[model samples]
Target: MEFTQLLERRRQRWTRFALLFTLFLVFISGLYLVVGEVFISPLEELSALEEQLILQLRLPRLLAALAVGASLAVSGAVLQVLLGNVLAEPGVLGISGGASVLMVLVLFFAPALATPFGFMLAAVIGALAFTILLVFIAKSMCLTTTRLLLVGVALGILSGAVVTWAFYFSDDLSLRQLMYWLMGSIGAASWYHHLLSLILLPVLIWLCCKGSLLDKLMMGEQHAKQLGVDVDQARWQLICAVSILVGGAVALGGVIGFVGLVVPHLLRLALGSENRYLLPISALAGAILVVLADLIARTALDSAELPLGVVTTSIGAPIFIWMLVSHHDSR
Candidate 1:
């Protein structure tokens, strides 16, 4: 049948895209490891100093970039489908805000616990607490989608207020460190952060598998119900999954923006909104973007490093504006 042939062609196209994406990811990852302030040749043997730089300094940072990027992108993709809004992303849910508040508190009151591992733990705890609050409020009040979004906004605002007060009270040294963190950076990343990836990997796989559920939900609640989907349970399942994914990412890399917001939208535009393709490809694309952005952040300035979030926002904001203008023109 002609219909079957059309499906086959579409499948082939996506297969090609996936293959190309994988190759591109590999290339950039290698580039990230080799090209930094001190460039080392991958083809040739390295000095002891080069080996230390690559192993101790760059490798851990590279891994963090990949994990954080992939996690944020997949989280964003799932969120857009769940909220039925193309603009929805992990930050809009207040998960990152919660993580930020806790991280600030640790730095302000308990600087002794402000080590890299300690901050990551604080972030995860804060994100998990906020997620629980959102779930409870949503379940008890029986909130509609718009109402739920407003609740999340309100929570984010509350967290921001608390952080502002902390800023007002903190001394000069803490303030500088806090500002750097708020802007986001993986320059301090260490091998211990790799433990967070154990949490990230399983969640990523689970979310990628939920593409079928997302497709069913896309049609509308009643339609999804007719398709034997339990709408309530699926919604909660997705919320919890997104909470963990976003939490782990924030914990690992601070509040790096735009990766979650822009990566999925770009993929959807290019590949179509089929969650099966969109979810996995978003992960790959997100990893590539973060790795490349980190590369730029470190090497862009000779004396001082750029913030990771600043680099991503600088790159993503323009593309986002163009996307908005293009959508308006199309309409």
Candidate 2:
């Protein structure tokens, strides 16, 4: 009887999550179809330009937002579990910063190789460098959660300084390009950006399935190993996956911040920290959040669009500070 009741409760819990996911899916559809400067009313007839605008511009951009948001959120959740730190994330942990810095260097120094494909490669290389270093240090040094966070932050700061330094030597045109990229726009979103998201889908599935192992790791490395988990292998797999996913996001969206930090954190607070649910739900919620943020970025002002990064940071900063304060209080 108890076992039956437990199964029933699990069913009900999953049902609730399914409903929330559906609602968010509907929200994203609404944003994608109708929520822009020139609304494409589903019920109304459209002109050629209007149809072209939706197909050529808005649709791709919305898809890009969804892809970037989901990738970052999943990466963040995985990192939080892998490191056992609420604050560990792709952006805050220097994955995005690393990508940004290397992409900048490539753009400035190797103009011939600074094409979209080349930049993506550089971003991946940079992201891998930092993520691998962190994973290595954490495993080798047995760093505390707080110490790990500090090291990540220090790496991010160093990356930021390099990105800033690149600005000084760049010409007017390059400066304009760099500034736009740094500000994080979906303005360049295209059908090619879809490729990045498609590559990440299998990776996200793998990470979600590893939730059980992560749960075991929460008990400690020894506990996870004793439970038959290959602790080192799983950890390295997760690190590589995060670097690829986060680097793809940066390559597609240009160093957009805080989606990783905010989405997983917020979902954990609302839905509890069960990785099975948290991982997938965070992906959906992240899609909704970024799509909505992009809508606001486009429609917020009379003549100019806000940077998507700025919108995210404005929301994420306060929540992040609250987490820090609460964490301190608990300690």
Could you list the CA RMSD of all candidates, in the order they appear? 3.3, 2.0
- 1-331 per-residue lDDT for model 2 (tens digits): 9999986786578569868787977777666767677878788888898889988898889888888888888899988887778887887788899998888888778989976678778888899899888877877898876788789989989998888777866667856776776777787888876777677788877877877777787788888888999988888788888888888888888777778888888877765677776787888877777887787788899788899988887888898888877876777
Each prediction's whole-model lDDT (CA): 0.82, 0.81
Count steric clashes of candidate 1.
Answer: 0
- Misplaced by over 4 Å in model 2 are 1-11, 139-146, 172-175
Task: After the best TM-score superposition of candidate 1, give how far the Cα of residue 106 lies from its true spot, in angstroms.
Answer: 4.5
TM-score of each: 0.87, 0.93
Candidate 1: pairs in clash: none
Q: Tens digit of lDDT per residue, candidate 1, span 74-179?
A: 9888877766657556666677889889888888789899776677678877877786687677668877656776787788888878887888776788576766
For model 1 the local lDDT of residue 135 reads 62
Q: Could you tell me how far off, in angstroms, the CA of residue 50 lies in candidate 2 after the best superposition?
A: 0.7
Indicate the TM-score of model 1.
0.87
Alpha carbon lDDT at 185, candidate 1 = 86
